[model samples]
Target: MRLLIVDDQPLVRQGLRAVFAGLDDIIVAGEAAHGAEALELVRRTAPHVVLMDVNMPVMGGLEATRRICAAGRADPDRTLPKIVMLTMYDQDEHVFEALRAGASGFLIKDASPQQLADAVREVVDDGAMLSPSITRRLIREFVRRPALPAPDGELSALTGRERDVFRLLVQGYGNAGIAEKLTLGESTVKSHVQSLYRKLGVQDRVQVVIYAYENGLI
Candidate 1:
């Protein structure tokens, strides 16, 4: 997997590059000090995924993500590069907005080298990835929210089986896990996932969960 590291700090960028250096399946394609430079490098390097810092000078990751994803949506034939926001602890509160801004997922800034490599591969293979703590935290937050009227149009749009799939999916199960739980084939699970995205007009599993929570479907 080719990667573009975007951060304002030189040492942080160096640390990330060094982590990938020993990995046989990973390559550090380029580096940028901030989101603006990352945007330019993204077009030139065409890295499969970008590890973008949430905060940077010139342009932050959120704005860069919006612009990049907006352009990608305009041309369906071209694949937009996946972005995973690299966030610090204080930035956890901004993760939801980052997803809305078009990040595929995010990781904590203090992630270990192996965790970093795994996150890159996970997003590429699964379409999204969240740190375990983030997953638990999101679920807890969703559970604690007071009930709201479910979005009938969105909820009713789903078939019974699709709702079954969505239930497990929002609980943080991936394709394999969902398939096993439903006793369905992996391709069948993938089809349901695609259907969920299409019907809900959501980009990733994270948004699916958010939708479920906000709509009181969780």
Candidate 2:
């Protein structure tokens, strides 16, 4: 997978580059010192993933992500690169805003290289990633919030069985686990997953969880 690294510190970039060196399938496509440069490199290289530092000169990763999604909307046929925010800030506000701004994943800067790489791969293949702690926090936050408005037209698309599958999904169950719990075949579980994704306009399990939490379905 082609990756663009965006961080202001040379050492941090070097460290990431070293970590990815042994992986045959992973390649460092470009580097950027700040958000503006990152956007330029994104346009030029069209990497599959972008590892972005949250804080930077002139612009921040959040804004860069917003702009990137805006551009993608303007050119709907082109696939937008997955954006993973790599930052020191793990505050609730920061996390909320970054996700709202179109980041597919968020990770702390202190994450191990393996974790970072895994996050990138998750976002690329599954459309979202969140560190364990981040996921916990998100769930807690959603639980604390007031009741969400009932999904008006959208919830009607899901069948009764799909809704049951979705409830397990938001609780972080994988296909095998879900199948076992529901007493269904794994292939049947996979079909339900695909159907849910189509109905909900979600690309992956992570987004399904997020949507469930945000909509107060879990």
Candidate 3:
């Protein structure tokens, strides 16, 4: 896959390039120092995926992702490149904002070279990735936070089965995983996922998960 690297630090981009240099399936298409340059690179190279740093001197990764995704959504036939954000902030309060901006994954800046490579591959494969530490912190924060009543009667709108599906989904189960856990067919799980989306007024799993957490639904 053709990959573009976006980070303010040249050394960080160099290290990522070195990590991909030895890999067969992954190739470094280009590098950029900020989100604006990254957008220009994407226009020229049309890379399959982008490794983005959350904070930068000029435009930030989150804003870039939002613009890229918005443009793609405007064209029905276009398939925009996937984005995986890299950051040093462990608290990562911007994670949800990044998701709202269309990021597919999030990674720690300090991840090992191999972990970085694996993240690139995972996002290329159309999967979501989150650093283990950030994942734990996010889950704990939502689970232990003071319970807030679900807004706009959204929680009450779900059927019992849909609620069951939502519960497991927020727990990080994929469609097939949730299917097996619920003893339902994979297609059934997908249908339930769609139903959850419609009822809860969400676009994707990330939004659903956040909604469930913020509203104390899970």
Best by TM-score: 1
CA error at residue 2 for candidate 3, angstroms: 2.8
For model 2, give the 10-residue run with minimal summed lDDT: 201-210
Query: CA shift at 109, candidate 3, in angstroms?
Result: 1.6
| Model 1: residue 148 alpha-carbon error in angstroms | 2.9
Estimate the TM-score for candidate 2: 0.81
Cα RMSD for candidates in order:
2.3, 3.0, 3.5
Stretches of candidate 1 off by over 4 Å are none
Model 2 lDDT tens row, 5-98: 9998999999999989899888999999988998899999999999988988888888888888678757757778888888886878878877
Local distance difference test, candidate 3: 0.82
Candidate with maximal lDDT: 1
98 in model 3: Cα distance from truth in Å?
2.6
lDDT of each: 0.84, 0.83, 0.82
Error of 3 at 81 (Å): 2.9
Give candidate 3 misplaced runs (Cα > 4 Å): 144-167, 182-204
lDDT of 3 by residue, 1-218 (tens): 99999999989999889989999999999999999999899989989889999989899998998888877767646667878889988655777678768787788888888888887777665457788887787777676788778786777788888888888888878888889999999889889887877677664566677777777666
Q: Which of candidates 2 and 3 reaches a greater lDDT?
A: 2
